[model samples]
Target: MTTFTVNGRTHQPEGPSEMPLLWYLRDLAGLTGTKYGCGLGICGSCTVLVDGQAARACLLHVGELEGRAITTIEGLSADGMHPVQLAWRALNVAQCGYCQTGQIMQAAALLAATPKPTDAEIDAAMSGNLCRCGTYPRIRAAIKLAAEGGEA
Candidate 1:
């Protein structure tokens, strides 16, 4: 049994250790907010917080996650009001909405590390997350707004 903490709860996920953390999160834990996009780690749809750092869930194996703390989008806030989520809502950042969870999670991590990131820094931090709807401008604005203490 591989023991790990996700969303502040302990879990002994069933299955092979090689199974991607994404599957364990979605299938085993029933946290579907983390998405599966390219599955090659090219798109950031499967991003999550591992020990408060952004990581690609699809690429991380459950075997390697023992004793780690994992936080999916669902864990961000009980009321869907994490600062990034709030900023996302307040700024109307979602388009098709498929990639917004990962985008918001990544933004939350970025703001956690650098509360006052520059535009270039935002681009650098978020360059990996792809949004097919072309919502880059809105995303940048929301990050700035979140940094400025905006909330939902």
Candidate 2:
């Protein structure tokens, strides 16, 4: 059995070792905040924090997650007030809202690594995440706002 932690809770998932982390998270663990888009991993919709770094959940297998810590959007904050989340809310970053969770998770990872990122850095980091709603401007603004610790 592969043992891992999700949102501070431990789990030993029962399934094929090749089962994708996204399926386990959404179907079994009931954490639907992590989205599934472009199963080929081209899109960042399945983004989640693996060992505090952003990773594509759809590309990860349960067997490789033994002893790893995974954090989905639901675990981002108990009060929905993580700086990234607050920034997202304050700036109204979502339009369709389908890609927001992945965007937020990716931004959180970026902020965790680089508290203050330049436009180039932001572009480079966020390049993998696609927003069909074309909210790129607002997304960048919110990331900057979060870095500055500003909300609303």
Candidate 3:
């Protein structure tokens, strides 16, 4: 059993040590907010926060994360009203909504670290998160709006 903290709660996930954190989070820990777009780490759809830094869950192994704190989209806020979330909503960032959770989670972490990120920073930071709906422009606008202390 590999023990890890998730969404402010402790979880003893049952699986192979090499099991991807994304699978552990979804199948074992029951935290589905961190999605799985691609099994590989190329897509940022399974983005989560490990000690407040955005990481690719699909790339992290459960065994390597024992005792670490993992924060998923569900942990970003209990009410879905976090500043970044609000900004995303205000900017209408979602189209199909399939990738919005990961997008929001990534944005939350970015805002936490760079409260006032520049356009280049936003582009660089969010470049890996692929939105099939092509919501990149709206996502960028939302990040800017959130940094400015209001919804987009």
Candidate 4:
């Protein structure tokens, strides 16, 4: 039994220790906000917060997450008003919307660590999250907006 916390709730998922956190989150935990892109951990689509740090869910096994805290996009805020989320929405950053959740999560983690990141810092932090629709510019703008308290 692996005991961990997701979105403030504790879960002792029953399964193989090698079971990927991604599967448990989407399947057993019924939290589908985390997306699956590259199982090889190349894409940031499965990005989530593990103890307040950005991590790839697809690469993490539940067994290794014992006593860890996880936060998906859904758990980011109670009213969907997280600064990053608000900035994303205000900037209209999503195109297809498939990768937005992961992008948002990654951005949130970055903001948590760097409240006001430089443009280069934003680019470096967001390098892992690929936006197929080429919304990189808007994403950068949104991150900056969020860093400034998401007033937009």
Q: Give RMSD to native, each candidate.
A: 1.1, 0.6, 1.1, 0.7
Residue-by-residue lDDT tens digits, candidate 3, 108-140: 888899999999999999998999999899999
Ranking by TM-score: 2, 4, 1, 3
Give the alpha carbon lDDT tens digit for every residue of 83-149 in model 1. Answer: 7888899888999999988998899999999999999999999999999999999999999999999
- Which whole-number lDDT from 0 to 100 does residue 6 have in model 2? 99
The alpha-carbon deviation from the true structure for residue 30 of candidate 4, after best TM-score superposition, in angstroms, is 0.5
Instruction: Pick out the ten consecutive residues of candidate 4 with the lowest summed lDDT.
Output: 143-152
Which candidate should be chosen as best, given TM-score against the real structure?
Answer: 2
- Please state the error at residue 53 of candidate 2 in Å: 0.6
Cα displacement (angstroms), candidate 1, residue 144, comes to 0.4
lDDT for model 3 comes to 0.88
| lDDT, model 1 | 0.93
lDDT of 2 by residue, 40-113 (tens): 88889999999999999999999999999999999989899999999898988999999889999999999999
Which of the two, 1 or 2, has more TM-score?
2
Colliding residue pairs in candidate 4: none
Who is ahead in TM-score, 2 or 3? 2
Show model 4 residue runs off by greater than 4 Å. Answer: none
Question: Which 10 residues in a row give candidate 2 its minimum summed lDDT?
Answer: 84-93
Candidate 4 lDDT over 1-90, as tens digits, reads 889999999999997999999999999999999999989887799999999999999999999998999999889998999999999999
Top-down lDDT ranking: 2, 4, 1, 3
Q: List the candidates' TM-scores in order.
A: 0.97, 0.99, 0.95, 0.98
Kindly give the number of clashing pairs for every candidate. Answer: 0, 0, 0, 0
